[model samples]
Target chain A: MNTVDFLNSREDLLSPGISACQGCMAELSLRVILKVLGEKTVLVVPPGCMAGAAVGGWNKSLGTKIPAAMPQLGNSASMLAGIKAAYDLVDPDVHCLAYAGDGGTADIGLQALSAAAERRDNIIYVCNDNEAYMNTGFQKSGTTPHGARTSTTPVGSVGRGKVNFKKDVPMMMAMQNTAYVATLTPAYMNDFVEKVQKAATIKDGLVYLHVLNPCPTGWGTKPENSIAYARAAVQSRYFLLYEYRNYEFTVSAPTKNIREPKDVTEFLQKQKRFAHLDEQDYEEVRRVVNSRWENLKKLAGL
Target chain B: MENEYRVVYGDSGLYVLDTASWRTFRPVIDETKCVNCGTCLLYCPVCAVKKVDGRIQIDLSYCKGCGICRTECPKQAIMWVKEEE
Candidate 1:
């Protein structure tokens, strides 16, 4: 694709009358995704940040002419399955997509999500994970990593923040062996869109993608550094990006060594959520990040 | 809660995904030009695109707001349509 071609389509995907923050990664994600999906697509959103962003009382966030529907807080997967089934009944050529957040995916709606994937539901599941539940407040969720403070995980001598590590969701989704499973970032738009396109073509099975969206208000970072912090997290190996299709792993980012790992200070210091972390705790956090990166590299056979 | 608004230079109410935005950096696919060849599908990094009933489709949740398919399509089927007016 030429630069002009890329430049031309951006105008139609994401319109301006939405409530997303200035540098909201989720907003950017919706635009890129809808542009390719086109107007003939159907979107199903659950009660998460996506729902709050996309469908408001007055202004529907999506810019595309594609029709969208909203399900309950934890029923997007089932809703997509129903929508696909109904569309099939009519024999119409349309795509059904379900978008949710980590809370909806890994916690409240886990059962429905697994059932849909196991049944080979003909839909795309996109989890716009900002690591915490930012819509109602910065409450922590399953995707929140250890040591990252949140509204649910306050900082004190008891601990820095979340007590548990982030869940290995992609691996779990890959376990379904449905068809396509990927973990991507807004930083890599080509890879991200390409994957979305591929998911659209796959046969009767579930296509699952977990996107790491950095939050300015929740993460206590500046709006300008939202993308920068996200890219750094991936490049630094703190949050690895990769794709797994039919059990084969392809690591998206390649880093030399995570030692010292670009100083977690930049990432940690920016967000008030992590303001409690001291220098001594930095070593533990670094160790965790390195270990996760090494494990992912091994999985990718890199 | 409330819809957010940004003043735009154009008369049309459309505000397309500005490719220049730092938060996003990819091309958008114009459905009018897409031919459902599925070539862009095979190479996509996230598998965001798919074919439902022989028609190419896109999944936004995993899309990362990238524009790879917009450039890769041979038919020039996918063009970037900006926001209304």
Candidate 2:
């Protein structure tokens, strides 16, 4: 199908009237993912934003006709693995998807995810990293960037937000030798859909997608700036877009060039979470972002 | 006949939900101003705007009134109107 036709042909997998906050990128990402995966897919969501978007309560469900299973916050990966194994026995053609938040993927559910990756489970695991525990009131998560204030990492007289850098979950998953591992954002819809399609074709092992879901509520940004922040993140090199498969690493087309990269501070300045960042903090963040950009360029053989 | 207390699966199949109640501002398209460029159909996060019968149609049931359609419309076709209580 042509680009427009392909996109338009997608059945709306997410039912409307669900309680997702305005300009919630997580909800948008799920909409795109469901459009790509279709009705044959089974989603295994944990206690995260996606879960709330999918099935709000016992009486209300705005999710698609595709079957969904809600596991505990830490058991999403294992639960998906078991479900995938059952699908393998019954119908190997079925797709099993695990959707979890950054806290669930990078922190609490890391062990389960690691176990699934080690076993080469045939499933697609999507980590909707909004950078904080947004559903539970914007607490600091493992993927929260340094110097970003959160409920748990408030900017106090003696403390300056989170001290550590965001955990490299994509790289960690790539190290596990998964069939496919990629990082994407809703700003680039075509690329995101292409990557999801590619992940579905890989049957040898797990497919991990670390999507940067910008949370307007948690990031303290205007609702309309959700896609703008995501684009700024890529332009600033804070979130590099790339995919790893068969030991081949390649940067996606949109983020491959850097004639004159935008300043990382431009991306951070818009969000109130970084309001407390001083000049020194900005410099430190720039240094770290530059270092990662260099490493990514080397890996991409740019 | 007995009242069934069991939960029904897939209550609405492709039927639009009435999300107008959730919106403080509702989008109204000016067909005269609209060029039928389909730009709003591409940017809507909820897939609320679509092409029907070769014309642009906004499904208000699922529209959260994010005003993305209004913001992205190239011809200034869509206008956001304050919802009356």
Candidate 3:
């Protein structure tokens, strides 16, 4: 099969009228998912960056030729379930996909999500976690990690940004014992696409895809450096690639250890998220990162 | 199915789970509590739980029972029971 063509198909789904900022990781992820899903799928999205990126005001859609439903933020999962039920009753061939941001998936919309996943709804649910609520002017969301700055978490007089760690969402979803669950990053296209395509073909319950999308505008990094930051996050073991199936958890990709825990300064220096961090603050962040990495290794049984 | 697979994204390898090797999401179906509302069937993505031979029986092979069936079932006839190793 021609893989290049498979990747090329996404160009059509990505139209020019959307409001995605330059180098927006959320837009890149939308393109990736659309390319793999193609015309045979229906996308269900709730309000967030994706809603703005996919469909602008006045009943206009970005460029997706396929069918779409933009419901309230919390209803994407339930709507997807309803759509799948309708399709099964009639066509049974179309793919029903629910795409939501971290705030919608991990925080606000999690209840409906739990209901959908628990029912083993035949839908591909993708959580494009850009860390914080970038669309709402960089507010802290449940997915935002400790030490990151947001309007709500404002880099304070105390010199610390956020004080809480990001939720371990992928593992939490996998704990549901569903057939497929994976953590991915745009830097790893081949891996991400493979996971998405596999999920598309399965006629089972929910398939959870957690994509770590970096936000240049919110994080105070260069627009061009978003993908680079994404790669760094994975390499630093801040985010590891893995999949869980049939009660076995497998690290799908090996995170070659980067020596010395990569001075949080490497990441902090680029993003405004840690602009307030000083020597003492940077060291504390480093310690937390190291502890998390070691615990991750233990979880993967490596 | 092909024995050979291509590497996608960051790595390559397939971990297969065969029938005997499969892990069931073992469910407890309390027929006494069932109202026959069909909420479980409506929400079940795999259709693993059904009115087989006139009563609710779970097809353990396909039922991961993520518990939408249990949660949505108004009568709460279904409960996710863990499978023993």
Off by over 4 Å in 2: A54-57, A60-62, B1-9, B12-18, B30-39, B73-77
The collision pairs in model 2 are B17-B61
C-alpha RMSD values across all candidates: 10.6, 2.6, 21.5
Q: Which stretches of candidate 1 lie over 4 Å from their true place?
A: A2-4, A54-64, A157-159, A253-263, B1-85
How would you encode candidate 2's per-residue C-alpha lDDT over A41-132 as one tens digit per residue? 88878998877664423344435566776899998999999999888988898999888999999999999999988899989999999999
* lDDT at A88, model 3: 92
Return whichever of 1 and 2 wins on DockQ.
Answer: 2
Report the Cα lDDT for residue A130, model 3. 89
lDDT of 3 by residue, A168-208 (tens): 78888888887688888876666777888888877878888
What is the Cα-based TM-score of model 3?
0.72
DockQ scores of all models, one per candidate:
0.06, 0.37, 0.01
Q: Pick the candidate with the highest DockQ.
A: 2
**Any idea what lDDT model 3 has?**
0.70
